[model samples]
Target: MSTERRAPLDRKRVADTALKLLNDVGLDGLSLRAIARELDVKAPALYWHFKDKQALLDEMATEMYRRMVAGTALDPGDTWQERLRKSSHGLRGELRGYRDGAKVFSGSRFTGIEHAEQMEDTLRLFTAAGFTLAQAVRATATTYLYTLGFVTEEQGVEPLPDERREGYDVAERARRMSDFPLAARAGAEIFADYDRHFEEGLELVLAGIAVRFGGS
Candidate 1:
């Protein structure tokens, strides 16, 4: 074996490697051992950075959020509705970028305070748009939860943009639900054209927020 010095590892490097491995081994198969093997280090080396798998996952989720924020910029002149739409879509895009990405992101906490800045900005935007502080938090949470839940289900069907799991065939589903006439017909609408469906659902969520919170 060739003897070559390796770069020192940190939390960011560990989390970054784990994120890339996520696309291959997925969340279930990912572990500190696997990450350590990829990094050419002993598994114990990782413990210096992450206490356990959940800690590493939190860091990975934070990295994902950081990348999402870095890549997306909202227009300052846009109305609250427009900003919400853009932020929602941007989040969906980021979550869909990896296998089991939404799952990885769901329920994971940030390892640092980096996300607070974005949260502050979002709350400010909503409050500036005529919502009280409480209303702003609720409105933002509503949209965020909708996006998170939507993408989780979306990833369940298509883990990646071009890769769809088995058992979701529309015709097969329609046939399976034949006894329920309307439900049988609804299969196609529910299963196909994810982009259009996501947009329509997002619009509905936005509409509800507007009606309840009095935003433009």
Candidate 2:
């Protein structure tokens, strides 16, 4: 036998592979065998580190949080508002890097310490703005819910197929779209640029928070 030591299987490599697989086949199509094939290893090799698929996915989510922290400063000099905006946009940009990454990383239970720190940063923001920890947590939760919900939808959009392209039946969709002028006119123009919407949502959150806590 050759006396060469194998490079230890790592969480980063595994997460990177999973993200690659996500871009290739999406959530429903991703699998251990696929990841193993991508890594040039047998399926059993992955088991040495992750135990099971869900465990691996959980680690991916954790890694996603760590990635957000790595990409952001959460700085001391920046006001809490600046911190929150940077953190959220950092995560949004990260999710934008791979297909359906937002869908994979969103929701509860899989979040690690880094994820908590995001909320803690938001808490610090609200606290600095003069709210208690409980209030800060609650306010941060609202912003987080909106952010995750928005990102998930955005990530899910690209994978949409011909069959799923709004059904192509304007008359059929008209009843559902009747009340919403914006949704009804969601042609290329509406989606080709999302810069305005992202800023608008962020502004709405900050404005709402300021109104609630600014007077104090």
Candidate 3:
């Protein structure tokens, strides 16, 4: 087939290859050139499909969102808390599924949507819980941020070697936890049983929203 007749690399093709590259190399090492190289094409060729790295990252985030949205219902059948919790876990799992996926989805204005497709999903949950459109927007933002922050940490994000090591299972971590009463008492609860911690956090955010809104 002629170069003109070459099948276009649609968004999925680009994202799939990018995802592999992400798994192969973390975000800092990722680039349009890397993706193009993986796909056996020139770096400029990627511009035909993605304007830039941010655009490609946005597409990748959208791919993860699509997967998350599929697991959580959009038909408004559950409690807002349930909906929100489901979205939170769905998103966390999506990010955990790919390499450097958490970094890609967390803390960036990929397309500067501050609110994206997942934001709509979150807003729908709020409105279902008896929130007005404005209230839904405001309230959902908090829960969304909380969810993203939780997931980012769940991916084992480190603030500092000494600071972040609290979650690590090293001997130094044990010695430090032993010295602090509260940290010692809560150590197992904090570092252990992530499932319980995530659920507890999910409940706290939901309850906060409820008390401020109506579900209490």
Q: lDDT by residue for model 2 over 1-216, one digit each (tens)?
A: 989876656877887789778877878888899998888889998988887777888888777777777877776666656765776688777777666777777652563565665665566666776887876766666676677777776555444321133444455555678798667767434343444667678879877976776613
* C-alpha lDDT score of every prediction, in listed order: 0.88, 0.69, 0.70
Which 10 consecutive positions of candidate 1 have the poorest summed lDDT?
74-83
Model 2, residue 15: what's the lDDT?
Answer: 79
Best by lDDT: 1
Residues 1-216, candidate 1: write the lDDT tens digits: 969866779999999899999998888999999999999899999999999999998898999999999988977677888888888998999999988898888899997898888788877777777889998888778888999998889888998899889999999998888999999999888888989999999999888987887964
Model 2 global lDDT (CA atoms, 0 to 1):
0.69
- List per-candidate RMSD values in Å: 1.4, 4.3, 4.8
What TM-score against the true fold does each predicted structure earn?
0.95, 0.77, 0.78
The digit string of per-residue lDDT tens for model 3 on 1-216 reads 555565567778888788877866778899998888888888888898788888888888877776666765654566676666776777767776765677788654444453366567666666656789887876666777877776567556332212333446644466787867666666566665566888888888878777787752
Candidates sorted by TM-score, best first: 1, 3, 2
Better of 1 and 2 by TM-score: 1
In model 1, which runs have C-alpha deviations exceeding 4 angstroms? 1-4
Candidate numbers, best lDDT first, in rank order? 1, 3, 2
Q: Supply the TM-score for candidate 2.
A: 0.77
User: After superposition on all CA atoms, how large is the RMSD of candidate 2?
Assistant: 4.3
